[model samples]
Target: MSSTNERMFTRRDFFKFSGAFGAAAGLAVAVSACAPADTNSSAGQASTGADASALNEDGTITAAISYELGTNGYDPMVTSAALTVAANWHTLEGLTEIDAATGETYAALASSMPTANGTTAEVQLREGAKFHDGTDVTAEDVVFSFQRVLDPANNSLYASFIPFITDVTAKDDRTVEFTLAHEVGVFADRLAVVKIVPKAAVEADPDAFSANPVGTGPYRMTENGANKTIRFERFDDYTGPRPARAAKMEWQIIPDPSTRTNALQSKTVQAIDSVPYLSIDQLKATDTVESVQGFGLLFAMFNNEAGNPFADVRNRQAFLYAIDMGKVIQTGLSDQATPATSFLHEEHPNYKRAANVYSFDQARARELFAETGLTKMRLLCTDHDWVRKCTPLIQESLVAAGIEVEFTEKKSADVYNTIDGVPGAYDVVIAPGDPSVFGTDPDLLMRWWYAADTWTDTRMHWKGTAEYEQLQTILAEGLEATDSATQEQKWGEAFDLISEAVPLYPLFHRKTPTAWDGTTLVDFKPISVTGLTFVGVGSTK
Candidate 1:
C-alpha cells in the first residue's frame, strides 16, 4: 500500500468524522445581515469609567479559541458552536438541555413535557430574568425566539431537527404553549439548543444583534473587532447555582496553533483547544501546562454520488485495501489516533467491535484492484499542513499496489467548493462530517449520508437500496421497543446492512487534545462530544 493513498484517507476521515463522537467541531463563520465592526474598542477601556478591578471584582480568565466564530448567530438554535459559547446562557434559561452523564434530553425552561396529543407543550418561564438590555424575559420572548428559527429566511442548520414543531405561543406571563406537527421523542433535546433571546432586541436590529448579541445568559457580549478579540462580562443577575468564578472572559482568536501554545506558556492565555500531535509530548513535559485528551472521531470520505472512478464500489474497496491505515495511524498521527474498526468509536456506548472488517491486507487490496482493473487516479486534498502531511503517505501506498496516483492541493475552502458543489471533479477527495452529540442514531447518520441527498454543501445524490430506506424508517419509528436492548438490536441490524453497501468507509478515530496552564487554572472537565465548557474552569487561588 502506498503512503500517499493512506494519507489521503486520513485527511478525509479527520474532518468528516470529527463530530461523530458527540460534539460539533470546526470554525463557524458568523452570518449576520450586519457588516463587521470594531468589537475590541472597550477591551482595555473600561465602561462607565470603572476600573478593571470594578469590572471583574474577583478574577478574570482568558481563553483562546482556534478559529474565529462563524455565521451562526449567538442564538443556539442556529449552530452548536454558538451554543457552546453561550453555555453560560443556561445560567439564565433555555427551553431544554441534555443531562451530561446519560445523554438523555430534558426540559430546562419548560416545567414539564408536552401533552400526549402533541398539539401543545406547557412551558413555565423562570421569573424575574432579564436580558442584558434590562428587558424582562417574558413567555412572549421565548415563543418569538423559537419562531424565528422556523422562519425559512433564517435557514437554520437545525431546521430538520425540529420538523415536528409548528408554533409556540405564550399562554400567560410565565407559561407558553408549543403546537406540534406531530409527537416527537427528541423534541426536548432539539429545544436544548434554542437559547431565548429578547424579541424586541432581535427585531429592532437583527444585523447589529449578530455583532452585539444580547441574551439573558450568565454572560453578556461586551466587545468584538475584526481580527482583534471578543470580550464578555459575567452576568451578576444569573440565578443558576454555578455562578462564574471569573467576572470577565475574553475569547482571543489565535488561528495559529503555535501562537496559541506560546500564549498559554507565556501566561498570556489560560487555556486552548487541542494541541497538535507533534506538540503533545512537549506540552506534557511542561509543569505549567495540563493536557486533556478529547473524544473525537476521524474518518476518510468518498463522494459516491460524484461519479468518479471511485463511484464504483470495487474501486473504492481497492483503494481502501491498497492503503495502510496502521502505519498512517502510527506515523502520520504520531500514534495519537486509533485505527477505527467500526463506524463509531470503541469508547462510545453503542460501539460494536468489528476489527476484522477494517484490517489492512495489501494482498487482498491488490486482488480487489486487479478485479476492478482501475489504473491511474487523482486524489484531491487541501493545502492545510495536516492534509498535506498525510497525502504523500497515501500516494506512495497506492503506487505500490500497481495503481497510479496523482496529487492536487488547493486551499481547504476552494477544494471543498470545487469538488462538493460540482460532480466528477476528482476520483477521490478528503472531507469531514460530524454526528450529533446526543447519541449515535443509525437512522440520523444514514439520512445525513444517503437520504438528505447532500453532504454538507455537496450534493450526494445518493442511489441507495430499499434495505437502507427501510432501515431509515425503522430508525424514525422503531424506538417503541421499551428498552435499550431492543433498540440496540434494531440499530445493529441497520449498521450491518449499511456496512455491506459501503455508503462510507470508516477510518480511525482522532483524539482532540487541549492544553492549559495548570498554575492558574484549578479544574477542567472535557465533555465528550460537546466542546470544552467554561463552567468547568476555576481559579487556583
Candidate 2:
C-alpha cells in the first residue's frame, strides 16, 4: 500500500472557507460610546521622577501573567506552560529563535545557521557565550541538550517535533554536528526546540537545575517561588543579540483575567496577558488593547481507540458536520476568529484547501450517525471562557443531528488527564491548541499533534492501525524529500489523508487579545499568543 502521503483525496463539493483575522473585516471595534482612557491621568501618564528613577535606576518592572510560576519547572524540555515557555525565551538559547509575531527565524546561541547536506548539519557556537552560573557554553553542552530530548526516557514533549534527528556530536569545543535520520526542509526552525543547557549543571542536580535554570541567555532566574511569582535578574555579563532593557522583571501569576486586567487598570502591573475577550472594549477605553492574528485553535479531538464510536470515520465526520461554525464564531468566539479548513490556514504560503470541508449539514450528519448505530455520546470540554459557552451549542448541534449529547465541563488540564488515562472514557474533546506556540513551520505543526508515539499513540489512541502507520511512513518520506516542491506536495498529501482520517481537526483560530499600560511601558507590544514578552522593553512612565 502507498504511504498516507501518497493517498489521493477526491475533492467533495463544499464551500470554500475563507476569512482573515479581524483587521480587514472591520471587527476591530473597542467601545465607540466610551472614549479611551485620559492620556493625562496619573495612571495613564508616562513615567517621571520617582517612577522613572525606579525603572532606569532600579531597573525593575512587574507584569501580571495568567499562568503560575514553576508550572512545569524551569526545565525547557518538560515545561509546556505558556509562561514558562515565554520565560525560557529570556533564560534559554536555542541555535535559532523564532519571532512570535512574524514567524521569522534569527540566530540566538549559534553564531549562524548550520551548513547542511542531505543527512548532516554543522554549527559553530558563539566565541564567548557564558551560562548564568559563569560557565562557558561549549559544543558538549549542545550535544547533551539535543540528546537529552531525543532519549525516549526523557519523554520530552518536543522530542517528536525533531524526529529527523538521529545523532548529535561535538566535533570541537565550539563546533557541533547534527546527523539527521532524514533531510528536514525546516531543520533550522526545528532547532528552536532544543534550547541549549549546561550538561554539568543538569547532571549534578537535575531537580535543583530545574528549580534554578542556568543558561546563556539575557536573563537569569533570581527566584522561582511555587504558584506565587518568578523573578528574573538581567545577566549583565551576557553577550548576545537580544539584551534585557530592564534590569529585573517580576512575573506575577494572576490567573484570573479580571484581576490581571484590574492590575493593569490600577497601574499595579505595567502589562498583563490573556485579557478577557469580553473586557477588550472596557480595557481599550482606558488601556491599550491589541488583538493580533493568531493560529490558536479550538481542536475537536476524538478518542479513536477500539469500542469508541468515534473510532469510526463516519461518526468523526458526523460530529464535524453538525457544528455550525458560523454561530460558534459569532457567539463563542468573536469575529476576530477565522474558521479553519485545514491545519494550514488561508494565510499560510503552502495552504491547500482541505478535502471534505465540513459545512453545517444536519441531514448529512444524521446519515453518518445512522451508520454508526449509535445515537448518543458524552462530550468532554474545557472550562475555558469561549469553550464553555461553545459546548452547549455543540451539544445542541448534535441533538439537532439526531444524536443525544451529554457534556461534562472541567478544567482543560483535568479534561486532558481523563482522556490520557483510559481508552473508551472520552467521546470528544474541545480544547485550545496552537502549533505556532512552538514553531511556525507546517511540518512542526502537523508533527506536534499527529506524529507517532505522540498525540495519536497516547491520547487519541489510533496506534497500530494501517492509517496510523501510513501517516508515520508519509511523515518520514516528507522529511526525507530534499526539494521544496516535492516536500510541500508530500506534506499536502499527508494533510489530505489526515482530513480523511479525522483523528482530530481544528475548528477555528481565535485572535488573542492582550491589554497593557502603554503609558508606563516602552517597546511593549501585545502578542497574539499566551505569554508576554518583555525583552528590550522597559518602563516609560
Q: Against the true structure, whose TM-score is highest?
A: 2
Off by over 4 Å in 2: 1-58, 69-71
For each candidate in turn, the TM-score is 0.77, 0.87
In terms of lDDT, model 1 sits at: 0.54
Q: Please write out the lDDT profile of model 2 over residues 80-132, one tens digit for every residue.
A: 65556677777888988765544557788889866578889889998799888
Q: Model 1: runs farther than 4 Å from truth?
A: 1-57, 71-77, 80-93, 99-108, 111-120, 148-154, 164-167, 179-187, 287-295, 354-356, 382-391, 408-415, 436-457, 463-468, 479-482, 529-531
- lDDT by residue (1-541, candidate 1, tens digit) is 1111111112123233322322222322111101001111121111122122333336677777554443333445454342334333423346665533234455555555434355567777655667777767788988887787777777665454555678888888888888876565555666754678788877776655654566765666565423346666677775543456677777776646788777777778777765666877777676233222222334445656544666666777677777787787677767765676665555555667643464677788788888877788877765433444566777788888888888787654455556656766766765433444432344344444544433433533345545446756666553434466766776676566555555555556554455666566644433332234454245543
Candidate 2, residue 334: CA error in Å?
Answer: 2.1
State residue 1's C-alpha deviation in candidate 2, in Å.
Answer: 56
Error of 2 at 505 (Å): 0.7
